[model samples]
Each structure stands twice: as C-alpha cells, then as structure tokens.
Target: MASVSNPILVTGEPYTPGLTREAVCETYGVLVDEIAKLGSAENPLGPSPKALIAIAAAMGLTEQYPSWTAEPLRKAIAARYDVAPDEVVCGTGETEVISFIIRAYAGVGDKILMYRPCFPIYHLFAENEGRVPVYVDMGREMDFRVDAYVEALKSEPIRIAFLTNPHSPSGKLMAEADIRRICEAAGDALVVMDEAYIHFTETEGSLHLVKEFPNLIVLRTFSKAFGLAGLRAGFGIAAPEIIRPLWNIKPTWNMGHMQMAGAAAALTDHEHIRRTVDLIVEMRGYIAQRMSGLTAFRMVPGSRSNFFLIEVMDDRLDSTIVFEKLLERGVIIKDGSVSFRGLDKRFLRSDVGSKVNMDRLADALAAIEQSL
Candidate 1:
C-alpha cells in the first residue's frame, strides 16, 4: 500500500488540551457538580446572555450555509476596533487563523520564529506545514525577552513570528513598548500577536499596533472573555494587504450561523465582558491569597491573565503528584510537564474559577499539604 498519511503529521506532537469535566468525573468517580474545572481558561460566568439569545435565534438557519465570509462578525469586529472591515478575517478559532497564516504566508522548510514556551499551536502548525520553527528562549519566569526576539527577527529570514500576550501558562502580559520594538525589527516577516487572553487584563492591547505596522496581525477570540469557547469564533486584524491573502485562502463559510451570531452579539455585550473580567480578577486574587499560605507550592507571580502557574517547592511533591492529588479531590488543572514545552514536573497551570471552585481547590491543597 502507498503511504497513507503525511509523515510530518504522523510523527508530530499533537496538541493536548486540558481535561474536560466529563473525563474528570468519570475517572475520579466525582459528581459533575462537585468538580472544580480550572484546567481550561474558560469563563466561569458562562456565555453572555446576549450571545445565548443570538445563538438560539440563529440555530434554525444551520441547515443553510452561513455568510461566505462571516460578514456580520467581520463588520462587528471592525467597527469595535475602528478598522476597515476588509482588514478583518474571521476563523473557526484563533487556531484556524494561525494555520491559515502558516499555509498562506509560509512555505515548506521556511523559518518561523517563536518564544521557547509559547501557545503550542504556533510550533505545532509550523511543524505540520513542514516549516522550521526557531525558538528564542524567554527570560527567567517566562518573561518576554524583547531584545532576544528583536535580534532573532533581524538575523533570521523568518516568514512569521508568533507572540502570545498575557502568555499562556505564565500569564505575563508584554508591555506595548516591547511589542513595538519587536514589530520595528521585523523586516519582511509577519508578526502575529495572539491576544486570546487580552480581555482578562486592563491594558488596552495592541490592536492599534496593526495600523502602525504593516507586517503585524492581531488575533482575538470570543473563546476567553466572551464565554463562547464552544462557539469557536475568532478573527484577525491586519493591514488590508496582509489580510487579503488570508481572506482569499480561508475556507468559504468558515464560521457557521450560530458561531457568527453568538460572537457578533457577544462583542456588544460589554456588561458580560466586564463581569467576566471582574470575576477572573477577583478569583485570581482569592486563589493567590489561598496559595500563599500553603508551604507545598507557591503561585508564580506576574500573571495578568486569567490563568496562573503553581510551582511545587516541596521535595516530596511534584507537579504530577499535585496534579493527580488535585484530580482525586475533583479539582482539574493542567500539569505543566504534559501541557507545555520548556516546563518540567514542578509546575501546574490553573485558570481562575468561581469562588466555590477556588475554595474547593484551596481546601484540596490544604489537605494535601497537611498530609505532607
């Protein structure tokens, strides 16, 4: 038989998502209602009311194809960001947009630049496309080393560079000045700013940087703050010149009726967004305070996003031990050894959850520490 699969995909490191509530419940024999699902950086408040209404209204149209370009969503995003609609490209999720950019702008064996521990999709998508991913080590504690990225951008003939602000696992938000410095250094390379968690922070974000840099693309998603992770709605903003190719190459009717409807409606639901941000901020603080009293682990500082990391300081426990113990206690979180590259057995990642959920996690950790 002829080779059935592409070797790159057959051998590639597949993306591993956080465990779902059902899986945890099944494995741990815990009731669904008792599980504290802090593994995924999901909005604990749930979907926006306006978005729920819009999605319900659009459900009947599922039999028909959606707008060829998800026009309403594009328009909504454009209007909110003060950009031309033509400059926006919608996708199933920011992951799809990342894939599209790689397929459209990069070719086989081309170079892609990214930080050592980044949103895994950047490296995974590049590898799948047969592009070479060149990694720049982040500063200690996952800080964005702007000078290192600038040096890499100036030295390499890179086709694209991926930067995740309020970075995953660590949640450190990069300053605008550093971002501008990297953008300036990118000569012919397209710089993709993945701001999936931007809403959790107070910074205004780098959407305006797109207007200043022709090679810049700003990606945002409804998955995080808008509470539409299941809806899978995301879009990218760039100069029309850069967006034209992405739009041209994207799948026709990429977003379904409900996805587009929910996302567009969610964009205007400012109150829901505010509540989500506030909840994350408040719960994160609560969790931080709770973790501070524990001797088994310490919460990594500098997190401005919804999720933060916990580093195991006690010799008797590692991330794997804490992870399994938390699972036994019906608290699900991402074990850094499995979820992220460049991290080890000492770290685990948890997203902000409801007060009750945080209390469950805190109580579980306290129990574990007392046992130790």
Candidate 2:
C-alpha cells in the first residue's frame, strides 16, 4: 500500500493547548465559573465591549461571504500601526499567518530558526511543511542571548527566523537594540517578529523595524490585548513585496464578517485596551508579591507580558505536582513539563488574571506549600 499521509506530520507532535475551564470542571468537580483559568493567557477582563457590540450587529452578514481582503480590518490595523493597507495580510489567526509565511518562503528541508521553548507553533508549522526547525538555547532561566542567536543566523543558510517579542512562556521582553542586531545579522533571510503579547508591554515594539528591514515581518493579533481570541483575527505587516505574495496565496475570505467587524471595532476601543493592560500590570504585581513568601517555589523575574513562569524550588514538588494540585483547587496554568519543549518539571507558566483569579492561584499555592 502507498503512504496516505505526510510522514513528517504522521510522526510529529501536535501543538498542545492549555486545559480548558470546562475540562477542569469535569475532572475536579469544580463549578464552571469557579475555575481561575490562568492557563491560556486570555484577557482577564474579557472581550472589549465595543467588539461584542460590533459582533452582534454583524450577525446578519453570516449568510453572505466576507470581503476577500478583509479591507476594513486591514485599514484599521494600518492606521493603528502607521502602515499601508497593502502592507497588511489578514488571517484567521496569527498561527495561520505563521503557516502562510512558512509555506510561502521556506521549501522542504529548508531551515527555520527559532528559540527553544518558543510558542511551539513555529516548530510545528515548519515540521508540517517539511522544513527543518533549528533552535537556539534560551538558557536555563529562559534568557535571550542576542550574540548566540546572531551567530546561529550567520552559521548556515536559514530561510526564515521567528523571534517572539516579550517571548512566550517566559514573557521576557527583548530590547529593541538586540532585535536590531538580529535583523542586521539575518541578511537575506526573512525575520518574523511575533508580537502577540506586545500590547502588555510599555515598549512601542518592532513594528517600526519592518520599515527599517525589508526582510522583516511583524505579526500582530487581536487575541491578546484586544480580547478577540475567539474571533481568530490577526494580520501581518511587512514590505509590500513580502505581503503581496502572502495575500495572493491566502484563502479568499479567510476572516469571517464577525471577526473582521469585531477586530476592527476592538482596535478603536482604546479605553478597553488601556484597562486590560492596567489590569494585567496590577494583577501581575499582586500575584508576585503574594507568592513571594512561598518557600516551595518562586516566580521567575523580568516578565513584561500577561503571563510569567513559576519555578518549583523544592525537590519534592515538580511542575506536574504543582499543576495537578492547583487543578484540585480550580486554579489552572501551563505545566512546563508537557507544554514547553525545553523546560523541565521545575517550571509552570501562569497568566496574570483578575484580582479574584490571582487570589485563587495564590491561595492554592499557599495551601500546597503548607501541605509540603
């Protein structure tokens, strides 16, 4: 018999998402509303009010197809970033855009550079397309070393390189200067700056870098700060030359009417965005301070995004133990032992949630510590 599927995908690991709120409810007998849901870095305050209104209003358009280009959403994104509409290419989500870039630029066996313990989509997409994923170590503490990355870029022929600003899992924000050095070293290779969580940080981010480096592409999403994750609306910005190919190859009407409408309205909701950022900032500090006294584990310092990592210090309790214990208390988070590639049992990633959610997590951890 002939082979029926791509061998790489047949053998490769699929991306593993965090446990859902309903899953916790089923397994632990917790109420659906009682779950803290600190696992998937969702907006603690929920979707923007304006976005919800827009989505409801656009419900009538469900029978008709959406714009082939997602023009309105693209224009809103362009105006927000000071980029041209033609320079933007919309997708169902940033993951779709990532797949598009991998498919368009890299051929089979081509090398795609990325940091170890990344978002996992980068590696998974490359493998799905039969491209090689080359990883640079993020160090034991998940620190980004520009020199090491630059060296890797120049080491061989790399077709594309993915850098996550305010990197995932760790949430450490890389400096602009360091990103510039990497772009300079990339030369002809395409550099993708995944800025999904950039809104959580104070920095202006690398959107401007797209103008400076023609080979650079900056990916943005309404999922994180804009609170439109369920809509799956995201776009990429780059030189018109790079975006043109992506636009041509992308599926027509990739974004639905509600996604386009909701995302566009969410972009204009500055107050909602501001409140979301303020909440993340406040709860992050609150949880950090609350967890400071725990002797079993310590919060990993220097995260500028909505989530941060907690490393279990006591040898008896690994990330798995802590993760299961938290689930028993209705506090859910990412267990590094299974979710992240390079991290071990000592680490877990927790999203900064509302005061109530953070309190649940802190209290759960304190109880676990007391038992230990």
Candidate 3:
C-alpha cells in the first residue's frame, strides 16, 4: 500500500484511543450487555423527564421546521434572568455557538485569546477559521490566575477571548472579581465565557455580569445539568447587536423543534435544576475527599465543579493506559492531553457520575492500583 498523509495529520492519526464496545466489555471477559459501563461517562441520571415529555409533545411538529429565532425558549431564558429576549440566541450546541462567535467577530490573520488547558473546540474552531488562537497559561498552582491572564492580554493583540467559568478538566471555579478584571483588560475585545458547567457551581454568578460588560458573551448548555446532551441544544447571551451578526453566519432553524421544546420545559423545571445541582455538590465533596486520601495521585485544590483533574505518580503509565485500564473495568474518564500542553502520561480527568457508577469506578481504581 502507498503511504499517504493528510495536511491535518500534524500529530499521528488524531489518536481517538477510545475503546470499542466489544473491547470495553471483552477486556474483563464479560458480555457487552453486562459490563459496568462507566466509560461513556455522560450524566448517569439521563434526560430530564420533563424534557422527555416536551419532546413527546413536539413530535407532531416534526413536519415543520424549527423556529429560527427560538423565540419562546429565548423568552423563557430571559424571564429566568429578567433579561430582554433580544439578548439571547440558541444553537445546536455550545460548540456551534462558539464557532459562530469566532467566525462572526474575526477572520483570517485575526487573533482570538483563550487560556491553556481549555475546551479543545476553541482552538479547533480558531485554527479552521483561519484565525490565530493566542493561549495564556492558566497558572501552575492555580486553575485561573488573574495576573498571568492580565499579562497575556497586555502583550497579545486579542480580538476575542473564550473563558470557561468553572473550567473543565480542572473543575476550578473563577471568582466574580477576577472575571471583571479580565473583562477590563480585554479593552475592545469581545469576551466569550463558556459557562457549560455553571449549574454545578454555587458561589459564582455569570448572568449578572453580562448586564455590566457589553463585551461579555456567555455560552451555556443543557447538556450538563439539564441532561439534554443528546438533543444538542445550547444558547448564548450577549447584547442584541453582538448576537445579531451571528444570525447572518449561523444556520437558520439549526436546532430541532423537539430540542427547542425540551429546552423550554427544562427551564420551567427549576426544581430539577436545584436537585441536580445539590446532588452534584454532595457527590463532589465525596469524590474530592476520597481522591484526597489516594496517595498515588495529585489533584487540583478547591474544585467546585463536577469534574476534577488528577496527576498519576507512575510516570511509566500514560493517560491512555490508565483510561483503557479503567474502561476495561467499566469506568470511563476524559484524557486531558487533548487540550493542554506538558501533561504527563499519568494525567486524566474524571467526571462525576451517579453514586452507584461512582462506587464502581472507585473500586475499579482501587483494584487497578494493585496491578500497577
């Protein structure tokens, strides 16, 4: 066979490293139907019952196109925060909105700023959109450091900045004051805050900040707390003029009718949000405490979110090995090297699942320790 490579293959084979169903179940020599199955690692609670009901009601509307403006959902979201509907726009997912924001504001040779160890989608969108992504280090000891970010902005010519409040992998929440400082430094640049994990944090408030900073755009998802990942619905909040440009670039009726209806229902179910957030908080404490006692790993301090990054001491074993080992035993985790630089082979990020699945993961990790 002839050897051929695509221009995008800067790194070998994109490296999915994910396990197949057969492989996942086979590793422990068990049937696919019976494996403990924590590797897929979505919300263990599944879709909200209210969302399901709404989706069911919208079934007949499948004959019709989704609402282009998503007017009803926008109004619902606005009412939740007492904002004007003009300030909101919905998308297929938060990732799609992020790409739209970057594309709408900047172009070839333009620059976008984001911190290191961020969601990989930001860099991917920037690179493909023919723009430069200027990355700032998130600081070694702390997940978010205002001084370093200010320094980066001081030196870089940034047209836009994407920040994840209650940042992923690290699962560290940023303070309101620090956010204001960042907004101040960006000068004329638009700040895109990815609050995908906002529901998981209690102390930080983002909706209030948008009213103060016209440059601020907040991206939120129903995928996490509302359990609507499968429906692919997320929305962005910004000044109407800022969001207006996006409609020109984005697909009209991109979100399905079912997803729009479901999202609106999810909003009305405030009790569900409260209960889900409370559960995550309790589980986070349990996991953090347990991980703290594990002498084999080092975790980031003061995590106030649903996921946490860990550094494994055994340098010989790569994150892939750790991930695959856990998968075999039915526990799945995110590998951090996808977004960050200088991550040792031992680094990995685990999401908080249901208590039952979490217990299985803990036992699996405990057993894997003996093998390692």
Candidate 4:
C-alpha cells in the first residue's frame, strides 16, 4: 500500500497573541493579579455576569447536544440587530461564520479581495481553502484604501471582500457611508464586514447596509463587549438568501449548549454591555491623555475603537523590546509589528485595561524609559 502524504498547511505569519497570566507565571513567576492583559481587545470589565450564571445553569445539560439551529440565540441576535431571525446565523464565533461565508461563496483559485493588514484570519482562511488573496495595499500611512478596494472589486473576479470595521491592531473605523459606496461597487461579490469591535464605538455601524445590499454580510461577536470570548459566541447578519447557504455549510451543533445559553443571557444584559463599552471609551481617552504626557511614546491618532496603536517616539526604542520588558513587569501588550501587515517593530497595540492596570503599564513604561 502507498503511504499517504501529509495535509497541506496554509503559510503565513501566525497571529502572535498577548501572554496569558498562566504563561507569564510559568515564565516569569508572576501572579495573575499582577498582570494587565491589554492585548486581544477583550472587555476590561471581563465576562458578563449574566453570561456566567447562564453558563453555570447550562452545565447540567452537558450530556445532551445543543440546539441544532441555536434558534433562541439567533432570535435574540436578530432582535438586537433588527433583522429577521432567519436572516441570522449563529456560530462558534465570528471567525467561523467568516469561514462559512468564504467557503460558501468563493472556491479554489477564485479571487478574494482584502485590504493589507486586515484581520489576518480573513486572509488565513481564504488561503487555507486554496483561494487566491488579491491585496489592495493600505499604503504607507495605513489610510483607508477605498479607491484601491473599489478598483479591485471592479477589475478582479473577486467573490469575497473582507473589511474589518474599527480595524484590528489599529482601531480605525470605516464609516458606514464609505462602506455603502464599496457595497454599491462590489457588483456580484460578497462584502464581509467584520465588526467584532463595533460595540467599542458609539455609532451603529454598517449593519444597515445588509438591508439595502444583498451581497453584504455583517459579522458581530460577543467576545468583545459581551465579554464572552472564552465561550466563542457570535453571529452573522444577512438576507435569508445569503444566510441559507451559510447554514448549509455550518456543522450541526457548531455552538455548544453553554455558549448558546450564555450568549442569549448576555444579549439580555444590556446594562452590562453598556458598562463594558463605557469603560473602554473612558479608558481610551484616559490612555490617550497618559500617552500625551509621556515623552517616550505617542498613540496613533484617529482611532475611535477601544484599543489604539502606540508608536515609540524615540528612534532607538523597539516595540518588541518594550513588549518583553513590559511582560517581565506583568503588563502584556501586543507587539504591533508581528500582529499585522505593514507595521514596523517600533509600534505596539493595546486595549484599555482597568485604572489600576493602566497605571501599572504607565509605571512600567516610565521605568523602561529611565533605563534607556
């Protein structure tokens, strides 16, 4: 018998996440409370209290399978977004839904349009499926490359175009009007808008675009504001025609019982969501204020999202070096160079943490500056 060959793996830079407290403890022997995790844009307030309770309640039903369709959670999400329940599709997370959208629409060798330095997963999944990723560079300044994107949509045989709203690792939000313009030009292609961090901003985002654009698929996640990252809860909003194919590709019981129940409970806890968003918004201001006072670093301006990128002002300072130093001091921030495309090693991306945590980070930076 002939030996089987190994499965082909997609090649690219793997997402380098912030260090967990446990990993830090093992490496540097620091306690969990000593660490301020400002990476991955998690809710600073942590998971929703109602979600915790619901998850606990769901533990009793572990032996049974989750609802095949997750109808209750879908209904809750539909109500929140003002779309029909059938127009929504629940998944383990927004990433899974994105995979479904990409696979459902684009096939092997089909062109998929993406802005450089986008949510890397979008490119990752497309490449994994053997789809060609056509890039429109965001250029040197990381400005929104709307003209480039529109040109690609019109010129290429693009099936899927992924846009990250309040874009990750930088936090620049693409306005809804601009998104509408892209949708109008996309012709036959599906425009996937990943709004995982949309709750961080005050605006409603491009969910409304789905109503007017049949090819628009809006993805939202509970991982950000709902603080349900560990549970892996999220949904997609699209017309029933678009959603039907996604449902066909999704595995039965893709979402666990606890995740669905926790997500549903989280949806009802609007006050908790409000608090989480308000805290991030408030700290975004606080962090920017703190950065202004620092001679060593400055934040990248114009981010309306919860987290923003910080560039070390000093020519000699490297963000990866600062990242290691901060990790030793129990503060974990993402080294921006490794996380996204087109970023140099001088920058770091961090979400707003609690007051005490932020203070510790400030102190850590100060100490590093003194040493330099």
Candidate 2 to truth, TM? 0.98
The sequence of per-residue lDDT tens digits that candidate 4 reaches over residues 83-197 is 8999999899898898898889998889999888777788777777778888887755567889889988998889998898887767888877789889999988999899998
Q: Residues 265-349, candidate 2, lDDT per residue (tens digit)?
A: 9999999999999999998889899989899989999899999999999998999989999999999999998898888899999
Instruction: Name the regions of candidate 2 deviating beyond 4 angstroms.
Output: none
Candidate closer to the true structure by TM-score (higher is better), 2 or 3: 2
Q: Where is model 1 more than 4 Å wrong at Cα?
A: 2-5
Candidate 1 shows a clash count of 0
lDDT for each residue of candidate 3 in 1-372, tens digit (9 for 90 to 100)? 654443333543232333445776656665675444433335556778899999999999888876688887888889887889999988987878997898899877798887887777787768766688887777675468678787877788888988898886677888888999999998889999899888888754587788889999989888888988879889999888888998878988787889888998998787787878888788777776676666666667766777777777665567777777777676666666643553556678777766775676667667767776
lDDT over C-alpha atoms for residue 76 of model 4: 78
Task: Put down candidate 1 lDDT per residue, 1-372, tens digits, no spaces.
Answer: 576345888888999998888998899999989999998888899999999999999999978988888888889998998999999999999989999999998899999999977778898889887899999987767788888889888888999999999888799999888998888898789999999999888888999989899999999999999999988989999998998888889887788999988999999999999998988898889999999999888899989999998999999999999999999999999999988888889989988889999999889989999998
lDDT of 3: 0.76
Pairs of colliding residues, candidate 1: none
Q: Which ten residues in a row have the lowest lDDT in candidate 3?
A: 9-18
Candidate numbers sorted by TM-score from highest down = 2, 1, 4, 3
* Reference-based lDDT, each prediction: 0.90, 0.92, 0.76, 0.84
Cα lDDT over the full model 1:
0.90
